[model samples]
Target chain A: MAGHNESGKKKSSEAANDLQTFSAENLQNNMKVIYYSQTFLSIVGGVIAGILGFKGLAGFILYFLIMAISSVGLIAKAKFSVHSYFDCWNRIIFDGFFGGLMSFVLFWTFAYDIVHIF
Target chain B: MAEDLVLDTAIRDWVLIPLSVVMVLIGVLRYFVSKLMRSYQVPDAKIVKEGQVIVRARNLRSGANFIPPKAFRARRVYFSNEENGLLFVPKGQAQNAQAQMFSDPNMAMDMMKKNLSMIIPQTLTFAWVNFFFSGFVAAKIPFPLTQRFRSMLQNGIDLSTVDVSYVSSRSWYFLNLFGLRGLFSLILGEENAMDDTQRMMQMSGFGFDPTKSLSAEKDSLDIIQHEWALPKFEQRAEAVLRKLVS
Candidate 1:
């Protein structure tokens, strides 16, 4: 029984290692899709926030809201079996969140200044 | 709160609009210029084959348990066989390969061209922005920032009374420089040369040494103890089905 348990532990560890192994090309392509989608959505969100004259905290809240909705949309698009496509839930939800933030703020400020300030 | 300064609408038309348009155009131009400058050299056949071999070994390592024991042993023998395996590299040749790469004039020239492509336009743009659009406030950010951001947001403007959220033209150029990466990725495809950050990272020597990775793959492949898991999976499935039926 002890030997069986040891073998089972080894098998489980090997399975874990197998799960970690992903095709680099596929992983890169998945990341690229997420990045592109986040960029497009964040820009759109920034434009909407600017048009609606959303203030400081409200604007950021809207950005996060858009990101959350995008994550949900991605999960739905994957048919809710995200592990088949991505390595983890974080890859689907938060992989490119910060990368998109700069573009979001840039467009946010641009639109805000254009419509409301200037 | 202090009285909000009313910026002239002319600044919007003349400075803001033109600055952004020119930056976008320049970005597009840089993309095409770099593409034209890039000389596509056909990689050596040996290197290609070695890379493919490494990939195959990696795949086998990952999927060893899925294949039958006999098949796994045959593949492992084909790779890790000490006498004449594909991964066996002569000690002298491996050292020569890296030294050959470093000594190649074409490689140096290629690096120089890439550096020139990145640097020339960057310097020119910085000079142009400084020459044409310096010394005035261009636009105000909607979000409030702390006083620490005064130097960054208010570049080329030296007013103690001005809020940190008021961006000057030079700083706007810098902002647009970093912020337009997403726009460039949208316009150009995923692998375009528009990102200076990526280019800078590349310049800082993130080179792939094939020999190092090849040996690493070989070592990992050497240690895999193959145990076919299919029979275990089949038994588990049968037990589960029997439980359901009973």
Candidate 2:
């Protein structure tokens, strides 16, 4: 009975040690790592979109929209599992969707507004 | 052919563009009632997902590059039951997530409802975000070709074949396709809350942790004794970044 009790105490102490080790610092760092990777991807996305001829305001807007989608996507991943990261390829595709839709609508809306204004 | 091309351009300038204007106008008209046009409230987070596996599918269109067709159902497992009511488990991995919904009547049913009441959002995040994206995707596609392309690219996933091993299978899961995360409330219970949780969940999905819980005794140790941990973790983060982007 003495031996069993010693073993139990040893195990419980070890377990407590382990649990305490995972403090808020660790969780924050984990979150920070995710935050940085997303920033990296967003920077890369802007350069690529700009280089591809979606330049100036349109390019910037395109980048913003892509970054928005990417950030949102990454946010979703982080919020869901605290594990997943940005879907690089999915973000690219959705950027096209978001960019295309926004460009098309912005162009559409501007035309109508101009006609009425002028 | 040139005349038709001119007509097309002219119509886009006049008809299509202005029609899109009307769409937004109507979108605003129904904005208060419609989740599609409104910004949803991000729930005060409870249990963040630890890890998830997302399977994405795209169509092999005959012309032009592929488009996203479907993202196979996303399944996320919670790290602990302590997270149940406080953390919003996605609907994708576990449906409804009401412990009472479990087939086993022996499970604590009433307490489960109490938990659901205190925590889980009136609307799930992923479904809420999809409203705007889906409407945008829908309004833009005029051709049957693009429509078919969208459909073929979006929902063509076979979720059953995937291997999703996570802590407690009861955590929520989401099925995202073509900017639409499948509606859980309508399929499970709440119909109006879709827009609220949809986008929030979509944003959170990127940050999920794949590792299950790790209990390390040294976490509690004094910093002087554990100064070695930070660099080691930094190294691990690099490895994880490589694997994540790869």
Candidate 3:
């Protein structure tokens, strides 16, 4: 009985020392990192749009369509974990979609005018 | 309105390429400088202990309901004891002492250092772009904007004829500052603080200082009412056990 109590105490202490893993805090941070990567790629897309001289609605439509395809590719790359993709849908999908729009316009202008305009 | 406005090829070679290069280079430079400016001060042991005590009290308040009431009372008694309860610090004395500790002069020094590092590079780059790349309208945005945005987007050029969608070199620089968060994180790893977009949010908090975070946590913890959670817990447990057995 004494041995069992000692082992139990040891286990409780170990649990105390261990930090919370897979908590809400960690999930939020992972989403932020994913958002960061998405924003980066979206700017690259803008640059590409500029280089290719795509304009107005045509470029805008193509940009999102490409982002959708890339998002699917990302899902596949995550070993088909569809749940992870939807975990932070607000940040990963909607925010990334809109937030990327500004930078896309910025770079798209620079690239398009530089390549095609003057 | 996909108007085929003719642009000279020379504008691309001179203005667009240089703007892109300068923006990327400045971003890289700012990343390294900010990293170098970051200060790591070891927090006082007493402060750490105080914070941990509150956390323990919090855990007990929430989760002790799972244990028997006797065990819960014992833990509560240990924390709420008159002589040395974890939460029983003399309120006025503790607050005064913490106010002193939180007002450490090193905090101001650290803030000054951080501001200098962030500002100096940014100002220098802004000046450089203004001097070298100010005259040219670098690119036209794919979408339209309001006339009001012309002042912002078309900074250097003073032309009513230029479409509101066209952006000058100066506006492009500002756009790149917020936009390249991805590129920096990709090159330097996700943990890097190179991008200013996040920092911009932090700065807009205005007068909120970093040193007050400890005291703020304490203040938040102090306000929590810790009614014990273990009363009638055994009855609930027994009902569950009986249900499972049946």
Identify the leading candidate in terms of DockQ.
1
Interface RMSD for model 3 amounts to 6.7
Q: Give all candidates' CA lDDT scores.
A: 0.79, 0.31, 0.64
Q: Candidate 1: DockQ?
A: 0.37
Error of 1 at B35 (Å): 1.1
Q: Whose TM-score is greatest here? A: 1
Off by more than 4 A, model 1: A1-27, B193-209, B235-246
Show the lowest summed lDDT stretch of 10 residues, model 3 chain A. Answer: A1-10
- Candidate order, DockQ descending: 1, 3, 2
What's the residue-level lDDT of B25 in candidate 2?
A: 38
DockQ of each: 0.37, 0.04, 0.27
Give me the iRMSD of candidate 2, please.
Answer: 13.0
lDDT of 1 by residue, B1-246 (tens): 457989999888898889888888998888888889888888888779999999899889888988899999999989988888988776767777777677767766877887887688889988999998899989888888998998999988889898788999999999899888888888887766335566666466434566777788889998878778776776666766777899
Residue pairs whose backbone atoms clash in candidate 3: A117-B7
In model 2, what lDDT does residue B194 have? Answer: 40
- Per prediction, the TM-score for chain B is 0.88, 0.21, 0.71
lDDT of candidate 2 over A3-116, digit per residue (tens): 111111111112122222323334444433433344344444543553343423564575566567655655454453322222223432343344233333233223322332
The true-versus-predicted C-alpha distance at residue B126 of model 3, in Å, is 1.5
Judge candidate 1 against the unseen true structure and give its global Cα lDDT, from 0 to 1: 0.79
Candidate 1, residue B6: Cα displacement in angstroms equals: 1.5
Q: Is candidate 1 or candidate 3 better by lDDT?
A: 1
